[model samples]
Target: WSLGLKGERRDLAPVSTSYYRVQAPVSTYHHRVQAPVSTYHYRVQAPVSTSYYRVQAPVSTYHYRVQAPVSTYHYRVQAPVSTYHYRVQAPVSTYHYRVQAPVSTYHYRVQAPVSTYHNRVQAPLSTYHYRVQAPLSTYHYRVQAPLSTYHYRVQAPVSTYHYRVQAPVSTYHYRVQGPVSTYHYRVQGPVSTYHYRVQGPVSTYHYRVQGPVSTYHRVQAPVSTYHRVQGPVSTYHRVQGPVSTYHRVQGPVSTYHRVQGPVSTYHRVQGPVSTYHRVQGPVSTYHRVQGPVSTYHRVQGPVSTYHRVQGPVSTYHRVQGPVSTYHRVQVPVSTYHRVQGPVSTYHRVQALVSTYHRVQAPVSTYHRVQAPVSTYHRVQAPVSTYHRVQAPVSTYHRVQAPVSTYHRVQAPVSTYHRVKLRVDK
Candidate 1:
């Protein structure tokens, strides 16, 4: 084994001994020697037996010895053989340290040995002589002793702490710290004081107060908030103008002038021929005009000339003296006179011859002839003639005319012979 006495340390080196043992005390110190100071890191090769040696000032040691399940190293403050004998036994295969200091107005802390698999702790103060042992299966603790005051805190995975004391000017406070699933604290003080503090799974519980608490207050959780905004916009408009007008036209057109005077001709001696023209109006029409005529006759007349001629004839007259002849003239009183004489006497042959002679006057006439003429004759001329001639002859002629002249004469004769001659040339 080795020993190190330094004012400050940076690292700890391992000191190994396999079965090397010793029978006396190992002492290593560093001091100013004019005043009291501390000692550090004294290691031993074996256990010691001496008890009466003294260091003239207070001492402090820090030692660590680690190995397997047989022996362990610890820091212990053993009193001098003249005061008391100390026997400390520790678990094997773990490292432990013990330190003790003299009476002074300073802070003192002690921690119990921790086992490797399951760590159990016992903490005691010098004057209070209170010893606590709890199975804090893998936990850590700190023990503190001040002048006339003591405090300790235990942090275990699943454990409890019950601390009770009856002192007027002394206070004991213990904390049992672990995961909140299985950790609780209970403290009982002098005057019927009991308090329990638990955390997790039940955040709020009830408590009974025998007396008034000096200060009581509570805190609350937090709250949240939000905000909103907006964006852009638009607009529109309309416009317009005015109105107008127009004109139209239609079909065909024609024009005519006025005409006057006489424009036509008639024979070679031209008559006054009036001029003709068409006159126009909304509906009617017009034209021109003329006159009438005459005649003549003729008449005719005719006149004729007539001529007459005369012829001579002779007759014998019986003029015998009336008395001589009458004597025997049985001349037949002819049947003409119807005489009744005896017929026998008349037959006496009286032959008598009578001759008659007649003389006629001579007539001489001169005739004047007249004829008619026409100036304008449309007819022919007509002429008529009448002629009558009578002479005693044996031939007789009869003429019947439209103009006739009649004459009568009486004559009686018994027998006569007469010759008449008539010539018509």
Candidate 2:
């Protein structure tokens, strides 16, 4: 029936097909549509099918897969994966992977973490360990880590410190005042200069002995030696001895007597007696025994007993018996004496007369007279008796009066007439 059927086939039924037999049948499909789709699609579908298929995903995933592909695949499929099973199954893969660590911002902190210790910072690639000592000291430590041994140089802490030490310099000084006698010292350091001043060697006063003194008199006397201390301090001394003395006289007539002293004695005696006369200047007079009146006697008459005597004169008379006389006479100009024979009643008489003298015999009995005359008279008469006869005459112009007569008469009686006359011329 090839007639026109109305088509309403809405059923879930099988439909039959018509085939045409062609003259030539192609053995392989040869066209762009027949190649099993491209290798890109297969590669994209590779992850969905196999139990161990790996996807060629991004390079990161690829790298992961290549490292642990089985484990990652099993894990993503949510299978019962054990850590030991994956670990046993995984290959000992060697990978040259470089892991970049965090970038190091090298920094340091400057701090005195403790008041007693010092802080220091070192160079790069250096490390250090610090220890704080209780007594404010610092200790350094080197870090020997597993990787490397780091070298560390530590500096002392910055802080204030104190210590007990000697002063910087040494010095010395000296001083002096007024009068200094001696100063002795030992110097320790270098000397600069020396100065000195002298005050006084003031004079000292003392005493000494000089010379011995002496004193003397006008006489030749020994001087006494004594010391006289004059000026300042002195003394005196006296000699121990006796001194001699002398005398001084006035004229030639000198009378000397012995004088006694403390040490010496003296004596006095009479010297020879001397005499002088008016005529002779000095005469040696002989000693005689004469009366003081006999030295001056004069004769007056010319008779045998009339005489004058000058210095000292004396006479002796010897006569015969009865009517005799004796006379001794010395005169200035002349003198006379009579010597008569033994009388048969006659007499012998010696007469001395000076100057003018006269004598006469009695005119009756036998008698005689001897006489002389001169200008001046000197006579000596004896104590005898004479006869009264005639008185004699005057014989001189200027005459001295005769001596007054005092008689001692002894005569025999032969009387005669006698005339006594007195004459003046």
Model 2: residue 74 alpha-carbon error in angstroms:
99
How accurate locally, in lDDT, is each candidate?
0.17, 0.17
Against the correct fold, how does model 1 do in TM-score?
0.12
Output the worst ten-in-a-row residue range by lDDT, candidate 1: 290-299
- Per-prediction TM-score to the true structure, in the order listed: 0.12, 0.12
lDDT, model 1, position 236: 12
| Span of 10 residues, lowest total lDDT, candidate 2 | 110-119
Q: Which candidate is the best by TM-score?
A: 2
Candidate 2 ranges with C-alpha deviation above 4 Å: 1-308, 318-392, 395-406, 410-422
Q: lDDT per residue, candidate 1, 250-299, as tens digits?
A: 11111211111111111110111111111111111111101000001000
Backbone clashes per model, in order? 8, 16
